[model samples]
Target chain A: MSLQPLACIIPPDLLAAVAREADATQRQALLDTLQLDQSFRVVRAENAARTVETTRALTPRVGAGTPSRSIYDQKHSTATTPGTLARSEGQAPVADVSVNQAYDNFGYTYKLYWDIFHRDSIDDQGLPIEGLVHFGANYDNAFWDGAGHMFFGDGDGQMLTDTTKGIDVVGHELTHGVTQHEANLTYSGQSGALNESVSDVFGSLVKQYHLGQDVATADWLIGADIVGPQLAPALRSMKAPGTANHYDNQPATMDGYVHTTSDNGGVHTNSGIPNHAFYVIATTIGGNAWEAAGQIWYDTLVDPRLRPNATFSKFAALTLRSARTRYGASSNEAAAVKTGWDEVKVRVR
Target chain B: MNLPGSTGDPSGLPDPAHPRDMSDAGLHVTYRRSGGIAGLDLVAECAGSDLPQDHARVARDLLDAPADEPGRGGTEREAAVVPAGADRFTYTVHITDGTRHRTLTWSEGAVPSAAEPLLASLGGLATPQRAP
Candidate 1:
């Protein structure tokens, strides 16, 4: 099956909302974002034909899991050519806010994987983190193009600010890189939903880790900052699915599971099912989310048994097994894992 | 005999949500495309009478062309390849001439390249409306 590279932080539904509310100029920018996304998708499909080794080739192993970072200035253009390197691994802060934010966020993402997962960069191959900021004129999205590059857009300044403003957004896009390397989940149906959910989980985890907030303290909002003020409250709420908008209406369980051909079988919407599940697991374990609950979910992700086309229940089962394996079957961690799926109405068996 | 997964009868084929059959002549077509993360649409309307001689000829030819089966066609395939992480805009082409009317919607990448000029003209006319 043909797979598409994971693309963009802002959900299309919200962008649609923005487009609806926007003036002509802003509306054009929204449409341009949609067009850019399509162009990137095409580029990813073309890139897939390249040899695996060529695409996955590791960067020179940075000694000791230290991040190898490269920040580029797109200068309000959509081109991917990292316009004049603004900063490198050991460089000082740049004058541009977008450049600096991109640099710092890449470091934070690298730190999360290294400190918590004992993994290096995206591929765990000590890959260099590459970021392109200020892409397009008021571009309204960010994406990781299956390859090792991340691109951020300057929002329309009303519903969205700068794509780099959300650290979780950075974590979210980079985790797509991680998922691409590991499971390479098929980007459609249930498997696609799993791919999106995994990114959101780790994205939230990275933010929580950076803020030193446990499950109770963390906001648990995915793209809250990036969505701006006037639009819906948050992008996606793990604690409360479908709270983004009445139209979002993401069900937290199989009972409300959406079966549609759009959004890769409602990957963003149905993801609420698993997102709510993870939230329950973390809240129940009741400490730093990245510790017990986070570890279980991460373990489940890298588990050998997990298939690329895994359904929601299939993923839930893997988490349960990971919990049982890491912390005995009767342990609170394992029980919490079960309750997480149970609350979302996803069968763990 | 219709079998599961069989690519047999055209009617038996799984049609897209809103399928349009433009077999009738003298119909006007309005094409709206929505896909990608923005979930915004590019809305364009074209009528036989509104177009100049050359553009009108192409519009008539395109409208008269055989429509694909109900499932996502060219544009949907292009957009759907990535799955649901983003909104792959679906294209809805509604054709009416006051008598008979039909509506068809498809995702990006599934839209035919031939529809490019037609959509461009309409998109040029469109002001980037939000998807309903």
Candidate 2:
């Protein structure tokens, strides 16, 4: 079936806060973003219903191929849909920092999935990657439309900088597309939180894999490079949830799980629980995160048992099963997986 | 966003849970807009004696709008599966006039065309901008 088209890096609550709290000048932009987001949601949903379904079979593209990337420029206007083409794969570097960053970071994201997971492009079919930069006037978010496109905004200088600056942010958005092609997790409650957490996990993995950083060395911060000077030091910290400067609502364990009815059931906030689990596993495994820890998560993401409406406990159980299957049940990898979930208070049984 | 998972029955009967009758017992209306980019809540109230006359008058005018009709004109079929970070807003207009309590919910990025006037009147009252 066709996947839903609803993904944005910056949570709705954050944008809502800016809209409600920002000065008149800033409030208008955030308001416009909200409108823009609704418009896109409608478009994606319609497109998905009509678009052809692609099965997740890990099959390579027809002509044994390479990465295909295209970058566009919106010129600070939301009127045009994908904007003007700025850069493409195998092309020379462009003058715009956002364009180059999107191109380069997207390349790394593609590399992480290809080299590490041995998966093809987004669709495992050499699907072309596209990005639109400077999407709106001081737009403070980035997103991947389920239709295979990444849109980055020049953040409002006060709360956020250029979204393209964050590699993990791009990775996070792309991984949403990955989840779409795979489990197609429902976008609400725990399933929605799992969808969000999956993106964060792979997003960090993309950064780690690109930088050659091991789990111990990785910062474990999702949007460290994108947050503006005035806001939090980072969006959310996997290693330490509430440590991020201004955005301190995230709870590292189940005890702190938020039960609000916003942010699609607090998908962004509750994601910290699973994020910490992944961090614990990777650090305890003590090596490149992509090796064992990341692999286990990846396997779980692509596993058939991962249903559309998976809960944290269900997902944790799947990871344990994947770990045991990949490594022996008594292997340290399996025990580390259990320990990771246990620390997060997600009973795997 | 108001009545999440409320199944559409196709029949014309109103949902029993959503009692449409406004209680003449006393008007108490509360408007809560949740789901901005930050997912912060904006709450505004117009109750028996607590609200100032000026705000109460505004609330009276807002309640004059049809309570039964959805604020946004059309239902977005795509919203059923919208993922987190979609950056849209969800608004809950809670009306409690004495024994009669009714809540109407709508979600979107832009203010509903019909509810703009109501939201505009309440925006300043509920979501006061930080004093810069």
Best by lDDT: 2
DockQ scores for all predicted structures: 0.05, 0.05
lDDT of 2 by residue, A12-61 (tens): 67889878988999899888888888666655654554343335334565
Total clashing pairs in model 2: 13
Worst 10 residues of 2 chain A by lDDT: A49-58
TM value for model 1: 0.70
Runs in model 2 deviating more than 4 A are A1-59, A62-65, B1-132
Per residue, candidate 1 scores C-alpha lDDT tens digits across B1-132 of 110110112232223532333443465867664433332334666565543444444455544455553342433334345532232334556666666555544443344555544444454444344223
lDDT of 2 at A70: 95
DockQ for model 2 equals 0.05
Tell me the interface RMSD of every candidate, in Å. Answer: 11.9, 9.4
- Compared with the true structure, what per-residue lDDT tens digits does model 1 show for residues A21-42? 9999999999888777766655
List ranges where model 1 is wrong by over 4 Å.
A1-62, B1-80, B83-132
Error of 1 at A100 (Å): 1.2
